[model samples]
Target: MNKKPDYLAHAVLLLGMLLFIFPIWVTFAGATQSAGAINRGDISLLPNLSHLGIFVRAFSFGSGLTGSAPVWHMLLVSFGMAMTIAVGKIVISALSAFAIAFFRFPFRMAAFWLIFITLMLPIVVRIIPTYSVMSDLHLINTFPGLTLPLIASATATLLFRQIYLAVPDELVEAAKLDGAGPMRFFWDVLLPVSRANVAALFVIEFVYGWNQYLWPLLITTKGNMDTVVFGIVQMITGDQLIPWNLVMATTILALLPPVIVVVAMQRWFVAGLTEVDK
Candidate 1:
């Protein structure tokens, strides 16, 4: 006989999903309403479909609250930075982990431990010195400056190292017997095996870079280089009246890219997190 469904678990999951989604629904509803209505506490559960053009307006013209740059530009900057940081972190971490896992080098464990130690000291702790270094390198007010400092990921390195270590020694011996060199083996075998983990890490790191506010704030001095998060903050904190509708619309737009990434990579991301073996 077939087992019955777990009603309690289903109910709990539905509740949790609604709890998470309700705020987004409210935001979207508010976004489609008038600023006057939202400011006057006339928020509604149902969105006004006629006002859907607000999203287009917000993306094209911005809120005009603080003479901020256009939303499209801000979005482009954020997207580029997020992509660069994610890919950079993955490549560097994968290489470093591969070296530490497969090759016996001088002070190898010491190097791995050093990378791991940096995880405890997050960006906030080293912001000052990091800024100084970036300034010294003459990378201020640039995209490279915005993304470079955030690229190194000790956590990714550690995860990749563990994955590499889990590879069977017999496989390594077989590769050796096949005359596969280091780079050859890494390209042919290790990378394919680590694909899921890479996808999961990319999602995580992309969100991390996309949501970055403080570092971008410090590094970028030009309005043209401002990220979407920074522009959103600027829209809120200005001396002029806050356009709640426009702000809400912009917020909704800002949420799209990362959501698309997560949804698009959902399968690989889930597999990466849950799968035990390559």
Candidate 2:
């Protein structure tokens, strides 16, 4: 059975969809033209097969990013950074959550609150001190430098903690009776049970890491270490004459990985986010 849609709701939805898609459509259209055409403010919604070579150029050779490394290399770096951040966040958050949820210790609440408090202080706020620490450690221009500072995630820990809290005490008792140590219980029981949440959080953290700009721009002195996200910014180095075609190509490339992750895992991602199991 179908019901008639509210006109107001339909209008609002259409408007929102247009707002979301207009920029992307414009980018796709611009990506198929010459830099000169785009620079001249002449763009149309027609595909230019001749301009397809621009994508090849952007991939095989670097564009306006002033980097000798190709866009593919930047993609690889972004993928590595994103994966490291996602996995690191999950591992640390899971362990921290397990400790807080299952163990009774001195200052446990204090430690949890301290970590939670950090959620208020974004990376921007601590950039100076964080950069100093990274510099002192000689991590600048390094992969670790780009990622390690960003891995401390209180939100993931909180999410996992909430999930763990919802688990039944009977499960723990059953595992205890089966001679399962804390590590054994966590590995064999909790981890398996939390797979959906892990996948969900992976999607979130991966996108966050991939989209990072300011930190990567600051830490990576070498052009080779730049991420695809920053690579796009470098394409428009100045307002004098922007390379719109190449910029659009790079933008599309940057959008693909996260988009693929979301599309491929939309089922599990949505489920995990909306329905945490006990």
Candidate 3:
């Protein structure tokens, strides 16, 4: 028989859930509160529904709080850059993972190890060098510069590799017997089998791209190309005082895309992780 749920484990999980959720709750409440209330640190458990105008003002970029560029344009630029990175990363990482996991080649293990070692290296350590390279390539302040370096993540490659490894060897052999070439086998057999994993990877990659701040900040110095995060920083740092209500509202808006993706692709996400175990 299966063991009963442990009371301590349940309690710990409940505590963790609250810890994670409390900040979201606070942010929502803060978005609804008046500027005075936020600045005064007036804590409220529930949203101040009477102050719903704050969200509307924030969404419309009509909030007099920040005289900087419009929030809508910043949002669009950020989304564009994020989508570019996400799509590029998914395509490149998936193909590379498929090749490394399925094919035999010279220095295969060494190559895999070299890529995987990036997982252990801190991103900050490479920022200066990456920036210098981008400058040399005349990519500074360009969208491509912001998106290119992160086109491959060690984590995504590792996840896809594990998923590929779970594929049945017979499927590969059958494809070979049917006169399917390596690329065809990869496209037809392996890819179809790993659809859930691919969807999961796309969602994960999208979130990483969307939330990327430091690199985008470094690469995009122009106001026109500024990402939402960098734009928010600019909003706060400008001559006008920080409007916590508007800030919280914009933050919630920024979070919506990733949240929607996770909610929509939840089944694939869970399945992707579960399949790796088998």
Error of 3 at 245 (Å): 1.3
Task: Report the CA-based lDDT of candidate 3 relative to the real structure.
Answer: 0.81
Clashing pairs in 2: none
Cα deviation of 84 in candidate 1 (Å)?
0.5
- Candidate 3 or 1, higher TM-score: 1
TM-score of each: 0.95, 0.93, 0.88
Q: What is the lDDT of every predicted structure here?
A: 0.92, 0.88, 0.81
Q: How do the residues 220-248 of candidate 2 rate in per-residue lDDT, one tens digit apiece?
A: 87888988888777767754577678879
| Model 1 TM-score relative to the real fold | 0.95
Please give, for residues 236-268, the per-residue lDDT of candidate 1 as tens digits: 887788899888998999999999999999999
Best by lDDT: 1
Best by TM-score: 1
| Candidate 1 ranges beyond 4 A from true positions | 63-67, 276-278
Global CA lDDT computed for model 2: 0.88
Could you tell me how far off, in angstroms, the CA of residue 55 lies in candidate 2 after the best superposition? 1.7
Ranked by lDDT from best down, the candidates are: 1, 2, 3
Residue 224 shift from truth in candidate 2, angstroms: 1.3
